[model samples]
Target: MTTLRDIALIAGVSGATVSNVLRNRGFVGAETSARVREVAQRLGYRPNPMAQALANGRAPTIAMVFSDLANPFYSMFALEAERAARRRDHFLLVCHAAKPDGTLDTAYLGAVAGRLSGGVLILGSDLGRADLLSAVPNGVPTVLAMWEDAADHPSLPCVTLDFREAGRLAADHLLALGHRRIAVLAGARGDRVSHGARLEGATARLREAGVLGGATLEEDSIGGGHRAAMRLLEAEPRPTAILATNDLLGIGAIQAAGERGLAVPRELSVVGITDIWLAAEMRPALTTVDIDTRRIADASVNALLDLIAEPDALARDALRIVGRPSLVRRASTAQAP
Candidate 1:
């Protein structure tokens, strides 16, 4: 294997100079740095990450823990965070912190302590347990993203979205279309579907409009939404619109509508939260609220990196960044039939 010393010898420079040039550390003449890199590339020298970590007294990696990657919403967030982390020349490790049953993995946090990871960014879905924050090591900085309420963790830094605003946007869009009979497809009651803010916001709007509607608690997936929609469609006064908590559920509602021979935006209107990419091209196209996943991911990773660089900042004051959501009107919603 080609070593730093071999490249240094071939380049006629000291190993320390070669190391500095390779690591982009202390200042080196531009010509000399280029020469060292040329020699290193010629010799095919690969820096030992473990040795580098040992020398620098830290790892060049961070971990992001989130729920199922099956959901395009979370997948998009991960992709954006990975891109942001790479820009800082830091490696990103994604962990599936939630089990198939939508419950937090108790062992996920404990396992992270064993890695050489410098910090952790946790998705809000995995923050169900109050004691989760206690599991992270004392020195490693942690950032929570996509949470509806950052106040629950007064001292922890977080980046979240206004789920209430998201809910209100969805409700307002449906109401403006003159749809009074609506049903919300969400997780079981007290299951804290999307931080519970979405349900509250939508329900408040329904009450204001004097609409008699309620939520049908179910799983947070396409199949779950289908099952819930099936039941909701059978009501005495069938719903004219369906407000799903996520894009997956929204897509599922469209599928359910199709199965019932109902034409979307004609017989029934469907609106979803989090405008995932798939929502735009579905058969009927979905009218959903858009949460800027890229912005949230970038903000979350940047905040965590800053925390890692200055752990003392957390002691001085907590950091909380919130992003806004907007409605994306598409083909899935129309006037009440």
Candidate 2:
């Protein structure tokens, strides 16, 4: 098997020089560095991650923990994050926190917490517990994405999206369309960020408009939306419009309405949050709130880089960042029937 030593021998440089050139560390003449890189590429030399970590006391990779990778929202965030990391010359390692049974796995997280330099980014939800935040190995910084506030761990920084405002926007848009009976399809109640704040905002808006009494809450996924919408449709006073917390739920609600022989925007209207790409291409082109995942990813990466460069800066004192959701009008919503 080809190794760094073989590359070094062929390039006529010492092993130490080859290592330094590969890592872009210490001082190596430009000509020597180029020669080593060319020879290493030709030999297909692969650096041992463990040895590199040991030598530098830090891993070249960062870790990102999310609830589900199958969701388009999370996938877009990961894509933008990976791009941001590459621009700064770093690697990103993704870990899905939920197992097949949909339970949090702490043992898996603890096992790989030791070998990372660029810190960790938690997306979708918390790390299953507050204590887990503090348990991050020393020298490993942590950041929360799409979460409101870190209660006990002030040291941990966060990049939040205004989910509450997003919910309010959804409700207000449907209300303005003259829909008095509006239903909300929400994420799991356990997910405090999206479910709690978002629902509260929608509720507040509805109450002010005297429509809160008729609103219903459903689960976040497509299947959940179908079930919940089916129940609502069977009620004495069915909702004229439904506000889904995410686009996935909104799409499901549309399908459920079709099964019930209801024409969209004629018998029922639907609005979704998170203007995922697919939302615009749906049969009626869903009306939704854009979360701007790319912007969130860029800001999070930049904030972490700043923190890593200035360790002593107070966490709160550092810039607090959030992305705002904007309503996008489409064919799925119209005046209430």
Candidate 3:
């Protein structure tokens, strides 16, 4: 096994310097730190996490419980969270609490708590508030990355996006572009769901413009968007604009439009939320509401770290961090034809 000493020798530094770089606990020269990490990576040197945990009396890992592993939005959040954790010399243990049907798997969720030590971050949920909270282990520092429509846990801090505002912004943009016949594609229809919040926000703005809008509840996937778009595009008075709940759905909408011989931004306009990387690269380039996953990741990580550093603070007021999303206009949206 490659040891710290081996990495130090390869990087021309002392083992203590290598240790500092690995632990992220002390200051090390930037150049030396880079060299040590590079050499360690080349040597495939992995610290024995269990042994280190035993020695330190705590794990240097963060547990993340996600409701939807398939959702691109959640997937992006996971990637950013992993990146943020690595910056703190920690690794991530991802646990999927929701099953394929979007219901909470209580047994799996309860089992995850015992495996975690340092901190936990919960993102998205489709279960009852009580059940979700009950599954989470108490006494562990925890942060909620996405706010759920449930009673808040006293010990958990929350970092979330202004999803309603994001929805409003998307609607305002399409309305400003003079598209009165608008349709929103979302996962569900209810105030309790985040998708509903976005829909309501958009509807509020659309209503103000004297444009009655429509909504379709679908799977919230690329395929779902495609199927929904096919139906919407075939309606008597086809919607000139579509607002998807996410980028994946937006891409699907674009595809559906193409299949119907409609040109984007000329015949049909589309906007999406979450601004995933693929949005900018898609044909016609998706106009989207940027959810700022990086900022959310940073806030979630910082909240967890704060809880880990000061457990007593959990007894005080809970910390609430909210990120605002902005609209990114691209080639996909234009004035009504």
Candidate 4:
């Protein structure tokens, strides 16, 4: 196995500097640190003692890096992923890798990925690919889990649901109820269009029916959805139905309707993607597309383990698509008024 000494010898750096670079300590100069890390990556060096344990016939552990843990969707996914990991005789760790501003926190990732954790599973579409490729070492086993766009392959192995199909299901459900005037509450990752696949599918579905819907962008949260819906509700002739990119936005739209004295499914209808646990528990129950979080979680863990066992699979850049998005019809939607 390649060690700090091997990397230090190759890079002509002291063993301490090699250790410092791998651990992300600020002790080494930029030039030396880069040289040391580059050598480690080329040598396939992993500083994690857990990896050493794996070589001795012990079970391994992997980490799930997520942007937000507070979101019920992520929490549910974490639970399912942990269960999946256990089934495979591997341990799972959930890391909150979101910066205060909700973007991907690369610093935390640089520390634990393939080091403190044996491998890593990155959750959500909000994290930038460039940030990811730079943060994770070249030799680390990594998988991008729950990615939004299946068409756009990343630098690592990927597992995702057909999010565009989820959007289509939501739009089709509303259209079936004779709702023509529809509006969208799109969730974004900072200024980037995070939920573009969902939006694209819905908009295309709407266009096929000769129906055009206006869309507004917002943060991917309840508060963002609520604010966006509040404004849409004030439009002249106001939309009779609202399509949210996800359940959190859908739930918020439902709340916004109530505050405006508009009865859901009567005066207004709302539909969301990603039928999380909270979606069913919400009053009037959220009508959303079930992306099957458990299946995706399980697939992600299995894929990461596959990469860990055979690092050569990274060269194939495997993209695993699991589960179809289906509509979960409930009280929040009905025939449009």
**Each model's backbone clash number:** 0, 0, 0, 0
Identify the runs in model 4 with alpha carbons over 4 angstroms from their true place: 1-59, 314-316
Q: After superposition, how far is residue 298 of candidate 3 from its true place, in Å?
A: 1.1
Residue 20 lDDT in candidate 3? 86
Better-scoring candidate (lDDT), 3 or 4: 4
Ranking by lDDT: 4, 1, 3, 2
Higher-scoring candidate on lDDT, 2 or 3:
3
Task: Compare the candidates by lDDT and give the number of the best one.
Answer: 4
Q: Pairs clashing in candidate 2?
A: none
For model 3, what is the C-alpha lDDT against the true structure? 0.80
Give the per-residue lDDT digits (tens) of candidate 2, residues 1-337.
Answer: 6777898899998988998899888999999999999999998888787566657666656677787887887888899988987787677889886566455566666655545445777674534455445455666666667764323223567776777788889999999999998887776634333466666777789999998643445556778778777877786688899888788888888889999999998999999888888899899889998878788898887676665556654374243556688899998999999
Worst 10 residues of 3 by lDDT: 147-156
Q: Poorest 10 consecutive residues of model 1 by lDDT?
A: 186-195
Q: What global local distance difference test value does model 2 have?
A: 0.76
Residue 205 CA error for candidate 3 (Å)?
1.0
lDDT of 4 at 215: 77
lDDT of 4 by residue, 1-337 (tens): 8988999999998887887788786577888888888899999987765644655533478889997888898889999999999897778887998787666677788787776667899995778777777767777888998888888867688899888888998999999999999998899866788898899999999999999876799988888888889999999989999999999999989999989999988899999999888889988898999999999999999888888877775554778889898988998999988
lDDT for each candidate structure: 0.80, 0.76, 0.80, 0.86
Ranking by TM-score: 1, 4, 2, 3
